[model samples]
Target: MTAVVDSAKRHTLQALLSLPSGIVRRLAGRPVEIEGNILDPEMQLVLTLRKIEGAAIEERPIPGGRRALVDAAKAVGGDLPIGAVTDLDIDGPGGPLRLRFYTPRNLAAVSPALFFIHGGGFIYGDLESHDAMCRFLAERAGVRVVAVNYRLAPESPFPAAVDDVEAAYSFVTANATGLGIDPDRIAVGGDSAGGNLAAVLAQRATRAQVGAPPVFQLLIYPAVDFAVKRPSRTTFATGFFLNKRFTDLTEASYPPAGVDLTDPLLSPIYGDLTGLPPTYVVTAGFDPLRDEGDDYAEKLRQAGVAVQHVREPGLIHSFANMVGVGRSGPEAMGRAAAALRRAVSTP
Candidate 1:
């Protein structure tokens, strides 16, 4: 019975995502309006379907949560075509880390690269989970994407992922010539927890001089500050996909004992923002982390950094992952890719 129900729900998910937005809106009924933003009708339908599916990843243990995320990504993430993919293992701060590279067609002699980090609240995400997003961006934006598989939390704890990302960036930069990449045009970007790492890396390039500095950063619905519970956390706390309970679980699972929640390394918004590269911050109106992303972009602006903040007023968190889904998610990610292409291509 459980297997049947799961299969039925997966089929329904595919069908619902295939429907026209007009039909999805009609089926979803009145718009979900809060804090002056109407949730996208497609996203609203998705939330309704999820409610029926029941038992979010947060309700389960670690392995279950990881499975849920990967399964969800597979369910909605269509196989986006890319020119090629290569995998290699490199020495990280702790041990060997696997890195995936997405190379698009129409190759340049020396292309810019994006050091992408996956977002699973620092616990569950990996190369398989975000493969579609990386493929889409690589093909559309015409950049080689170096997706990092940093060590996860509880086992590796806070600074381990941080150290691994720093090490990965340094390794890439040091080997740019051999890799056929232009070291100066590398950008650091990620979604959610990955976004936090990308922001921290961007800051560290100038502050600590970690490696060759990123030319730009694309922070998609990043959790910038852990110390504050902003109104968005309350407004869209429940009924939305990323509920407060799930976020709380992730918070508890990621940081180890005695780590300060407000440390700049943990929360890059608290760090010095000046001298960072050009930044493109993407936030979703219905997301719990929206306010913090806003504040981070604002802080970068105030610090005299070049920042472009774009809020998809109708989408939810992780909307960028739905590359094969309904209208809104793909459109929003298209804009993000265009921004990234422009940012990295500037002479």
Candidate 2:
């Protein structure tokens, strides 16, 4: 019976997958020019439309980047749940970092919490880009989620974003009681660059003696290694939402220009994963980051860390963020929520 239900659910989700892409293409046309390794204005416009459409449930302009896209989201997405949204300001190693909290509705006392990081290859994106996904996680998993708005690269380089993530984790663990959360049930999670941060936090938590250890680490299409050559990089480099040139631009924007690409914290697949927390790592079939995510999972398993790796065939790198726009978005959320529940329910 459970298998039947699951199959039906997947079929239903697959049927709805084309809606978001169509919506994005119609709203924003293709790019006219490509400049400085970044997508042309027209392509950026299309990307913005896709982002807004995917995050349409509770769209708002984040701290930086395009504003017109934000306005369009506001007009279409409608009001998100009140209790599910709140702003947070906390002191970090650099200074102050901002966060957005998404609390699940009708949850029990001392619910599990997820420290979520949004994806943008360490360059673009903010809380607004991931609002819908966060809400879906919170409500579906019955977990409180705090999405950190770590400083983007170029403005703040290596270790800066990592520092903010660490600070946010520290603050949350320290104030868990006040926030009505179980410190023991805290998990760290993210996609793309944010996924890299989550992986780093898992290592940091194991090394440092501060606060509760992460109950789980959830990485979705994580950019795990900067050096190791992967087949996906060459095969799926172009036409995908994330391309090699843009990825190079993003990496170049980081501070301490020419930072070793093999650094473990920056590219965690190269890091020691022996003592990291249990992990759930998801990868996309068509994403350039696919091999890295797979390698990270294999490394974790070899290191004896409990790891469950899911490779979503036919999916793209940013599919997790496309729930509002893509037909499979909601289904992806459901899978993630299930994983979070499993991780949280474990000792």
Candidate 3:
């Protein structure tokens, strides 16, 4: 019964997103004010469909909500064909972590690789949820994409995710030859909480003076400062998909009680930004985390780190997952991947 309902919802979203771009854009643009900020047409349409299809997962039980969110993302993003996709398990900080490799057909001998982490506010995503995005990056940038399935919150809290990121990166760099990747050209990236992990990992590697740190970091609307509040949080507090309630739930699960949210591992914005690799930060106008992402980018620039920041003024959180919704999703992802390719391919 549950599977049938999910299938129906998936088809509904897929059908809606298959409409012509202009029609989708026009439908999305119809004026409807919510929470002070006029929601982006694309986001508004997505959210409305979510409401009707019972696709909003934040309010559901964690296990079920995670599945629903993953399904919805996969449905909207639509899978892409890759040269080859392989799944393997590698040793991580806590235990074993699943890793998926998306290699373009006709992969090069020593291709650059992006270590991707999927976003779900720390609790609700997995590799399958981000398969489309990874394939897009792999195909567009002409790089192998290594997607990590790190441990989640409540079960694996705080430093667990960070540790898994480091472990996965270490495995990739150490075994680059076997994986057919360029060790020195590896990069790290993710959206939302996954971005937070990538950012924190870069800082940790820099501080530790790792001989071969990630060549680049791509953060998409990252949750940078878990401890502090920004204007965007209040301004876009209620209506945005990443609202206070959803964030609060995810935050609590990861930190638990008595844990300080300001810990550098928890909030990478407070960590040392110097000596990190070149970074490309993407921010969405309607996201509550926008200010923190912008602030972090500025700090990286001020610290003499190379930073390319792009803010999509008419987009909302998780816009990247709306690939079939319109051109914005693919365009944003394509631009980010192009920058990533340049950064990683640099001599």
Q: Per-residue CA lDDT of candidate 3, range 1-347, in tens?
A: 76676566657766666688667768666755534545566667787766666646888888998888877877677757789999999877787789999999787788999989888988889998888888988988889999999999878887788888888877887898799988778898999999998888788776764325888999999998878889989878876678888888887888867877788889988888888899999998888999999999999999999999999876789987776445667888889989988887754
Model 3 residue 81 distance off true place after TM-score fit, in angstroms: 0.9
Model 1 per-residue lDDT tens digits across residues 230-298: 999998898888889978877787777677888988999999998888899999999999999999999
Query: Over the stretch 1-347, how does candidate 2's per-residue lDDT look in tens digits?
Result: 64454345334333433346555344445533221122223233334544544532113232333343233322222234635588978887877888787877787767889989987767677787677678877877778998988887777888788888888888899999788788889999998989988988888787774456888998989987877768888877776566777577656666366778788778777777888888999987667888888989999999999998998765666677655433354576579789998889744
Question: What lDDT would each prediction earn against the true structure?
Answer: 0.87, 0.72, 0.83
Best by TM-score: 1
Q: After aligning candidate 2 to the native by TM-score, how far in Å is the CA of 129 from where it should be? A: 1.0
Alpha-carbon shift of residue 329 in model 3 (angstroms):
0.9
* TM-score of each prediction: 0.95, 0.79, 0.92
RMSD of each: 2.2, 9.3, 2.3
* Lowest lDDT block of 10, candidate 2: 33-42
Q: If the candidates were sorted by their lDDT against the true structure, best first, what order would they fall in?
A: 1, 3, 2
lDDT of 1 at 151: 92
Off by over 4 Å in 1: 1-14
Model 1 worst lDDT window (10 residues)? 1-10
For candidate 2, give the lDDT: 0.72
